[model samples]
Target: MKVAFTAPMKPLDHPVPSGDRTMGRLIVRALELAGHKVEVASTFRSWRAEGGEDVTREVKKLALTHAQEISEQWIERGDVPDVFLTYHLYHKAPDWIGPYLCAKFNIPYVVVEASRAPKRQSGNWALGFNAADAALAQADQVVALTNSDAQCLSQVLSKDVLTVLPPFLEEARFEISQSVTKGSADGTIRLLCAGMMRAGDKQFSYMVLAAALKQIADLPWRLTIAGDGPARAEIEPLFDRKRTEFIGLIPWQEMPRLYRSHEIFVWPAIREAFGFVFLEAQSCGLPVVGGRVFGVPDIVEEGTSGLLSDEGDASALAQNLMSLIKNPHKRENMAAAAVENIRKNHSLEAGARGLDKVLHAALERHQFKRKAHGGR
Candidate 1:
């Protein structure tokens, strides 16, 4: 099967490195791994970070124009895709192309990691909300990245159309020695965090982490943050300069080594939609500690592979951190479990298998429906 993929939030090859881009690339890779030919449908981003009605109107118009052109070109080349797949569609960045192309070509439409916010039905994001709702309704199958997202989507989409596919990693990319030891040689617990230091949720997560670290000041641990962004100046002062080290923006290839070197992966993960870092860290055999909110718990099995504290609760987060720091035995056990958990449940092969099943079902259902409608 040939799949036409589009990510309205951010293109898969976007120059800036972000979790969104990473997930987009992962989806493309997973589809290819499933033996499907994947083509990126468009690079036109529809994300509107902050805008009024006029700004959104212009973006929608531009998106529709791009979609029209792409459809015409594909038709001219006699190479329309068999399936249309859109990733990460929400009110902030609704897809305007996939549905149009799928309708024009009479192909199966699938949406992955789609979230629907009913509250945006009549607000500044009303246009985007409606557009996303329409796309979801038109989808032959909607793949939710987490149960939380699935629940929200169920409000508007049928339960039959919804399926939960957890976030996954390409395990082959991270090669860690099975005999590698946890923590540094001098008995210092090495904690690592990898996230862009931006304002809003990222900055707030940093503040929460800083507060948690302050509570465990007496513990024998050192934190190394591996990311950089505009809010670094504000985020830096929140932590003790001596105990914390900031190594800005480690390349993607080097992240696995960084995770292997650390004993624990810590991130407050405020409002996180299932962080890929958690999967990456665990794949490298490192236990994780994150706030218990949204999809964090989906990846980090509490008391099994990692620990979770209540979202934004510095005290609880601190206690979770201290528990791991004080008990090297527990950390080592969780580290082993983390690696196994990802291998069994979140590996690229697992995701590829899941996609193969879902995409094939979608194609069959689409054909059945079309036949029922007398080929429309």
Candidate 2:
């Protein structure tokens, strides 16, 4: 099937390196891995960061123009997409092209990582949120990455339209990286945390981590912080600079080694939507410690692959850190379990298999429905 792939939040080829972009590319790769011919439908982004009526109006106009452009190009080339697939649909950014083009072309429309908040229908992002809701409503299948999102989507979309896809990693590279042992059981416990130093919840998570580390000041550990962003000045000061080593921003290829070199991966995920880092770290055989809220539990198996603390509780985070620091055997056991968990559930092959099932089902259902409608 020819899959028309697009993400309104950010294009797959967007220069900025973010979890959203990473997942978008990963989803594309998974489609290809499943033996599908995928095409980049558009790089146009319909993001409304600071909501306003004028901004919404301008974006809607731009979206319509882009949709027409794609339609014209497809007609000229005589190559219309068999199915329209979109990734990441939220109030801040929503699908404007796929939904329109799919409706016109009578192709199956599918969404990955789509979240709907009906309350936003009258807010600043009212236009974008409604646009997203309409897209999901038209969608033949919606692939959810977390149980929280799945539960919410179930209320709006039919059960057959929802498919749960867990966070995953391209494990071949990580497998090789993990094979080369880096960190050791030498008295020093190497703790690593990596995420862009952004304001809001990200910075809040950093502050909580700093406070947690401060609580365990007496513990034998060397902290490595890997990330850089606009909020660095505010975030770095919260930590004891002398005790923490900053790696600034790192290249994607180097992340596997970084995770392997660290004995533990610690991050107080403040309102995270299932962080890919947790899975990446665990895939490299490092035990993780994060907040026990939202999608954290979906990735990190408590007392198994890693541990979780109560949300926003730095003291609880500190205790979990201390427990891992004090017990080497437990940490090693969790590390083993973490790697196994990734191998069993979060591998690229697993993601590709899951994606194939949903995509194939969508195509089949679309054909069945079309036939039922007298081949319309």
TM-score of each: 0.97, 0.97
Candidate 2: lDDT of 123? 71
lDDT of 1: 0.90
Rate residue 348 of model 1 by lDDT.
89
Worst 10 residues of 2 by lDDT: 175-184
The segments of candidate 1 whose C-alpha lies over 4 angstroms from its true place after superposition are 176-182
What does each candidate score in C-alpha RMSD?
1.3, 1.5
lDDT of 2 at 135: 86
* TM-score, candidate number 1: 0.97
Alpha-carbon local distance difference test for all models: 0.90, 0.88
Write the residue-wise lDDT of candidate 2 on 119-160 in tens digits. 888979888888788888888889999998998889888888
